[model samples]
Target: MRLITCSNSAPAYPAPTDTVLRTGAAGGLVPHLLALLRDGGDWLFPVRGRDEPRWPDRIGPVRLRPVPVDETDRRAHYETISVELLLWLFHYLHDTVAEPAFDARLGRAWAAYRRVNAAVADRVPAAADPDALVLVNDYHLMLVPGMLSGRPRVVYAHQVPWCEPDYFGLLPAAVRREILGSLLACHSVVFHSTRWADAFVRCCERYLPGVTRTGETIEHPGGRTRVVAVPLPVDAAAVRALTTADRTGAWRTELDRMADGRRALVRVDRLDLWKNHLRGFAAYDELLRRRPGLADDVWLLAVVARPRHRTPRHLAYESACRAAVARLNETWRRPKGPDPVTLLDATDPADTRHRAIAALSTADVVLINPTYDGFNLVAKEAALASETSRILLSRTAGAHDYLAPLVTSLDPCDVDATATAMQAALDRPVALPDPPSARRLRTAIGADTSADWLAAVLGTPRTGTAGRDVHPTN
Candidate 1:
């Protein structure tokens, strides 16, 4: 069967030979696509740039088509709209307390957003058969499904706590209706967790009149949309291979030297607002202050990657994080002792991947304290990649759904609680074995590879609790 999927950026399948790196949740979907292609699934995706050659047009059974955006000005406008407006809107990143005002510039950006989606929709039919299964990905192409009405299509949401009615109300009424109507045009919708799925359904019910939900399916004027929750699984074998590689060993040695006999608390994430870098630093500082004896014995290794688009806000956040780290080091560093916190840049993909694996392997505690996340893959990756048994995760993270019972869950907004969890984790016996729940989670994630995830997304019947209520008493 012919399959077509659209995403904002092309996956870096067969990792580039250059030093250029691709990271984040957008590239996270690449491995699953690669697995599908290896298993003989016919797939097609658009490459963004007009200047870049479409070398290796076909990888195994998958085909690559370049959707040229030759106009540089329009391309930038489209990207600005997607990142600054649409992304923030869907991710709930805006400050609701402050009244928001939209000017004509935003209207122009929305127009560019429409143009970008139209460009993607224009390429879909040419790349697929008349009866092909079209799968649109994420908020970037929310309008693509509506554009391809009467065809079998699915749209997958990669963000959490899907848009509420108030969030939608921020947009002009016409734009809001257009987006909801476009989504309703799809035959099916998918999310990484049940919480996000429920939010999406609730938003529809609140905003769109005559919308009805029945057992994970939502019916509206255009069509009935089947909502499915399939948590994205980690490529355990790949992560294992990376962690066990020869380079990883060398990196581990270097990391050990850097640690200087101090226990390492590792956190790997992009420098973004929702990642909660500042709060994490505050928690670590609190941990150091509360346990003076352990201050010289413990270190925070924050392996933060640069943001995809270096907006002003991202730059300011990075500056603030650096200042916080500096302050913590000044206050907590003992005579001739290592800095209490070490920040590492993960801009080079190959080097970053190796360093991350090494950090995970050597970590005594892995801290994944995101204010919100779609699915914090770092938590899962740490579970598989680390020799350590302790992980402190945020309750708001979607990964908490699967790993709550296994991890030390903390309210990321609560600094004292996070500090307490960190202290408790550091104080735990090093010889203590991993919890049975943690082992089960690791096994379950490993067993369900990206191949299985792809099959389920493409309509393969599978039974299990992917969206079960997992409340951990911590």
Candidate 2:
């Protein structure tokens, strides 16, 4: 089958099969999928941006059709729709929309969003093979599957969390209708977990009349969309290479030296509202206060991945997190011991991936406390980073249930509970990778794997040659 993929932004790095995917925010997806698709097959991932035209259409067999839009419309589309509307729609942030020309801006956003998708829809027919599988990723292009004509198998993959019908109802009826209706047009609607998959099914049942959900499949007038939770895996080999002692040994060595031979806890995340960085800091602070002696032992190495465009919220979050760190250091920093809290947001993020992995490699615990994340790959990568490091994960995280059995779970918002769990994880016995449980984790995380994810999304049985991935635990 001919494989075609579409995403809101281009891959962060040069993507699969010698494809030079110009820089954009594709969420490090290219590498994960690159590792997955081991067998040979034709694939295309159409992308759009103001600078997209400079890149060629085809890099070897992988076609990157540039669907460029006007500059002004692109800005309005990216700022309002992709960043604001979709993130707000998912309730990633609790703040109310506060911007000039809110409704009018939303109108422009919707128009630009549609324009990008329509341009992409126009490109599909040229590359459409007899049996084509067009995989649409992210909330940015929910309308693409519906806009495209028949013959190409469409799979709409929602990488983020799906809101409940009541919260989704908050959107204007027309907006919510378009979102659900277009998503229902796909051959499959994939999510990171059964939690979000079930939410999508429920929303379809609530909003779209006559839509029936049988097991994991949603049937509507358009067709059946198999709703499955296929969590994407971390690029384990790449992470291991990054953490190699020769490349970044100083990171862990320094962390241990600073911690005065005690525990070093590393929390690496994009400095975003949804990441709950503030709460994580507060929990750590509380833990230190509760057990002052522990402060000399446990240290927090916050390696935040700063965004390219720092919004007001991002700046404010950075400010607040810094203040908390300063306060923690003032209270707990021992002259001869750990610094108490160190926030590393000033470094070049392009080069920090290896450093973060290196730091986590020597950590006693890794904290991933997202308030409500669709799927936090950092948690998976952290687990892969160390055999002895205990992971303290958020219960609301999409990977929580799958990982909870293996890692310590905590409520993201509960400061007291999080602090308790942090201490517990610090004390938890280090279970070396062994037996049925560890085997399941390794399988779920794309360890020693191939392209079963592609097959699963395409509704085809996994061939013997293809490797493994997380199947629906529900």
Candidate 3:
């Protein structure tokens, strides 16, 4: 069976042919899917618009084909320019509103969207060959499932459909409604959370009542719609093992030096506002202020991803983070206390691994307080890796529902409450499960590897059988 995957963002690397990776955040799922396909299956990974300049150094054992389409392939610059001209003329002829008129910018964005869709259409293979599944992912490729003529199409809902406003900040109401309608035409739809699925169904009911949805609702009279939840899984064993087996011992020393004989507090994530990096810092800062005695004993390692954009908001946030770190250190750094909270940019693989291992080995608490997240894989990885590290998780995270029993929950937006939660975690001792029970839990979760999750949801065949062992390919 051949699977075609389309995502808005490019995969961090090409995955094995048997398991295709698409748009959305890069997390534990990427490696597991690659390993599954490497063991068996053919996979095709296509980015929505542009290809990466260089592929990642590893693809495990699976064979992968990188599908590349030029940004200019779908629409000629001259053609897009002409469409804008016609739109302006049509609006002028109808005497539409003059200042900041509606649907004015949409003309350009629409041209680009149409161009992207056309480019994917140009590359889409014929489905008459049979056994081909078109898997479209996220809002980036909402138009792609509709472009597939004969192939069985599936769309993965990584976020609430109403979150469209986040991506298309200025998209008109009419355009957003149309896009939502267009996206629901897929043969099947899969959401990670029931909350998101319900939100999607409600959105569809309000905007496109007559349209077919991949849900159990009467929208599909013949029972054609297939909508289900497949809470994405993380390889608990692999993460724990990889983290524990940190080949480089330098990270251990770094954590030791930073700890200064005290406990460690940690948060690992991209330095985006959405991730609430600042709010996390605020909680740690409050902890330092309220418990001056603990300030010297608990170090906060806020490892952030490198800044990817130069927008004013992004730059301002980064600046604020840097300033906060400096101020907090100056206020609380002591001769006998833990080293001043370290705000490190762990963006590179080596750096990220270093931080992960250090947190696993030394952290007393792991804070994952994202304002909103499709999934927070680190919470799972951390929980599996360290017996002593207590998890402080955000309630809004998709993984929160699954990791509830394993974590100390907090609202991502509440700094004071999060600070209180952190204190509570520190006051409490680590919770450990029986080794046999941990192993059993790990095995049960491993069965939901990205490949298995995708296969079950799409009703596709998996390469490895019930008793087969799967490994990553070189």
lDDT of 1 by residue, 47-116 (tens): 4465447445555455655565546435544456666766777667776676234677667666766776
Alpha-carbon runs more than 4 Å astray in model 2: 12-27, 36-50, 92-102, 431-436, 443-450, 461-474
Top-scoring candidate (lDDT): 1
Over the stretch 171-238, how does candidate 3's per-residue lDDT look in tens digits? 35666565555555666677655545555566565555464654344263223555655566666555
What TM-score, computed on C-alpha atoms, does each candidate reach? Answer: 0.90, 0.89, 0.77
Q: For each candidate, what is the lDDT?
A: 0.72, 0.71, 0.58
232 Cα displacement, candidate 1 (Å) = 0.8
Instruction: Please give the distance, in angstroms, between residue 41's alpha carbon in candidate 2 and its true position after superposition.
Output: 7.2
Report the Cα lDDT for candidate 2.
0.71
User: 458, model 2: CA deviation in Å?
Assistant: 2.9
Model 2 residue 175 lDDT score: 75
Question: Predictions ranked by lDDT, top down?
Answer: 1, 2, 3
